[model samples]
Target: MRIIVYGSLRREQGNSHWMTNGQWLGDHVIDGYELYSLGHYPGVIKGMGKVYCEVYRIDATMLAELDALRSKGGEYKRELTSTPYGSAWLYVYQHSMAGRKRIVSGDWLQRDKES
Candidate 1:
């Protein structure tokens, strides 16, 4: 299965170690979505903007591990979304975005540099 990673799961980020087994498919920009700052990481939700992400192809074992790390039903909800490369599962924020700062640039790494 393919997975789209936008925040800490991206290359060189804190949680990227978990994705080491997957094959890097390259970077992609997914539109019709918004990214918000959640301090150490970023959250994505359906909206009217773009999101920068990296695509990866992983096996069911890796998927299970990722789902566990993401806490599927709590912090984030996995959703099937279309990416430039193809269709893939991406995590969307589960709770509220009321007080979170929106990442206007849609690029988490760029947003981090601004801080």
Candidate 2:
């Protein structure tokens, strides 16, 4: 299966170890989503914005592990979202983003450069 990751799960970021079994497809830009900062990581929700993400082909085991990690505390939900590569699973934010800072560029790495 394929997955789209826009935060720490991306290459060189924290939590990337979970993707050791995944095959990096390439980077992609997904529309209709907004990125927000959740301290050490970021989350994406359906919106009128665009988000930069990485696509990866992973096995069912890795997918299950990621599902658990992202769904913890009900912070995110896995949804099938469209991508250049194919329809991939995306972790959509599930909680209120009341005070969370929005990453305007929709790119987690660029968020630091914007600071």
Best-performing candidate as measured by TM-score: 2
TM-score of 2: 0.96
What range of 10 consecutive residues in model 2 has the weakest lDDT sum? 106-115
Error of 2 at 62 (Å): 0.6
**TM-scores, each model vs. reference:** 0.93, 0.96
1-115: candidate 2 lDDT, tens digit per residue: 9999999999999888989899999999999999999999999988989999999999999999998898989989989988778889999999888999999999998988776
RMSD, one per candidate, in order: 1.4, 0.9
Q: Residue 84 error for model 2, in Å?
A: 2.0
lDDT of 1 by residue, 1-115 (tens): 8999999999999899988999999999999999999889899999999999999999999999988988756998899988767899999998899999999899998995655
Model 2 scores what on Cα lDDT?
Answer: 0.92
The reply for model 1, stretches above 4 Å from the true place, is 113-115
- Candidates in order have lDDT scores of 0.92, 0.92
